[model samples]
Target: MSTDNTLPIEHLRWDAASARGPRELNADATAAVTDPGAGRWAFAVADGVGDNPAAAAAARTAADAAVGAATSDPRGAIMVAREALADAPDTGDCVLVVAVGGAGDRCEIAWVGDCRAYLWAEGTLRQVTEDHTLAAYFRARNLPVAPGMEHVVTTSVRTAAAELIGTADVPLPAGRLLLCSDGVHKTLPTARLRTILERAADPGGAVTDLVDTAHRLGGQDNATALVVDRTAEHTANSSAA
Candidate 1:
């Protein structure tokens, strides 16, 4: 009898980048939190209402609160974030997307407002969450969307009802997961975003390319990008080779 002795390596990885762009203050925030020994993690991105003086605070608060829920509780995390916001109106309002997963094949995603979550697989990028905006609402009914109405958000961390929160369960290990603010998506077209992600060497590289791409393209708002990878780049490269 022969005994095999090759132990598998474990690696959990994610990266994020934030830039002020043309704004005086960065109203965007990102968080990557882990629950040690629990085999679960959380990643979030928030876009603060630009008009509010406390927009940055709101963005940070929402992200921190959501990730602190300790595991992959997407909807419950959003609820915790909302309640946290309700307790501190001075922080203003923000839109957010939270993804909870680990080195697993699936993730739970929840969002309020326009922050977005996307999955990239084999050079294809698919948006996993919908924008809770008036534009989306009107377009859903086949109604003509007016100019600028697309920016009007229907729900947010500070104002969303329980039913207004959007939730999803997406396959993660088959690809990479991305959470980004509107600054990234609005400034970079879907094609451009996909190209950047496809060219990135890894999740950290992807974060830099995505955020810098938006800024270099003359973004008018704060930008943020968070990317999570279930598989190590070296492992994938080895398999490919």
Candidate 2:
């Protein structure tokens, strides 16, 4: 994503990992990286919607497009994925989540479907993005979910316009930021995840441990995790240092 002078380039480290769960033939997709020049990081995760053969490919393409366009508005990133999806008509529906942050002590998210983003600060982990599934909608309205539609997503990048998508902006927190697919969050409790994240010393270890934890818990779909650390005790390029 694009970053201005206001974005912080130091004291931030990030990493990502993805794995195909028991039922999927291949892994979904994930991306995370910092822009050295502009001092911003773009993060994304995508899961293919159904059993369509092209689902995996769709996830990869959508994720790439989303992160690539993150430099501008989050909506612009989602719209770019929409255009890419239209060009590849055989791709299946997919859920997408994208987060962009710079030096301003703030982060913005754009999402479609159920992939999620969270902020873990001061030992508390809170969801930052809302799920667009029918189940979530019903829960938000305090109504019972329709039978067999709990998993049905209300919108997707390939299926909705920019205006119909979801967006959120939150101040950067003192701890770790996580982006994950349903496979990971669905299989593991947030309390347990907090423990894992708090213990991780680096993004690579944190994400790897998360994927493994989901697998150990019997993930039924592809699982992915991305971690961004803004704590002062660490820096993003320490590995390279």
Candidate 3:
């Protein structure tokens, strides 16, 4: 999708863990940019896989590379990130999600693993990405799943090299878009998430409530979230009229 109209946007990012009890720092990083010239805005989140010093670094590397590439060429962002990962010392897995907003209410997203993006419009919530997890596969296969067993993921950023990329595109209306890590999904059900997004005073409040809800539910993993709200940008010619 592509848009010709400019729009106002907002973003936020947070990390609230150090990898369990003694990990010292969370192994995740995120970055975003708004490019009016290109009529697009890009945002990405990268999660380091495994318990290693380089995990966080790898995540940062992925986020930085993805965002940098998006700035120049949204289509090339994933390729740039993949190349960066190839050159970096193999540490573990990392998942990436990149969202690009464009003129005419167009939005595109690319992702790997379970990191997710959601769009809310007209009182409805829609998830835009598929989770590449073992559990998801099982469910797709019509297997019976027990409660509390859903966390046993089979695919993640740490997955084998062959399964590290996923992508999607959608038209974004004048509403809210949510980009988040697994922690938010793990704690807050989709119903609750929708409610929060619907009632949130602003993008910042939505992100805060998301993280807080995860912590309240005994946040076992690092929690992070970003919220973007869209508003039409008035051009000089349009405004003058």
Q: Evaluated with TM-score, which candidate comes out highest?
A: 1
Model 2, 1-241: lDDT tens per residue?
A: 3322123445677778888767747637886555767766787888888755688878888988888878657778888988888899888768899998765568899899888898988888889888888888888989988855657889987888777788999877557889998888888898878988989988889999999999998777778898888864433343335
lDDT of 2: 0.80
Clashing pairs in 1: none
- Report the lDDT tens digits of candidate 1 across residue range 1-241: 1011111222456788998877888888887677545656788899999745698889899999988882757888888988888888789889999998754566899999999999998778999999999889999999999968878999999888878899999776546788999889988999998998888888889999999989898888888998876665534644565
lDDT of each: 0.81, 0.80, 0.67
Ranking by lDDT: 1, 2, 3
Between candidates 1 and 2, the lDDT winner? 1
> 2 or 3: which has the higher lDDT?
2
Candidate 2, superposed: residue stretches over 4 Å from native: 1-8, 233-241
Clashes of each: 0, 7, 8
Off by over 4 Å in 3: 1-24, 71-75, 145-164, 232-241
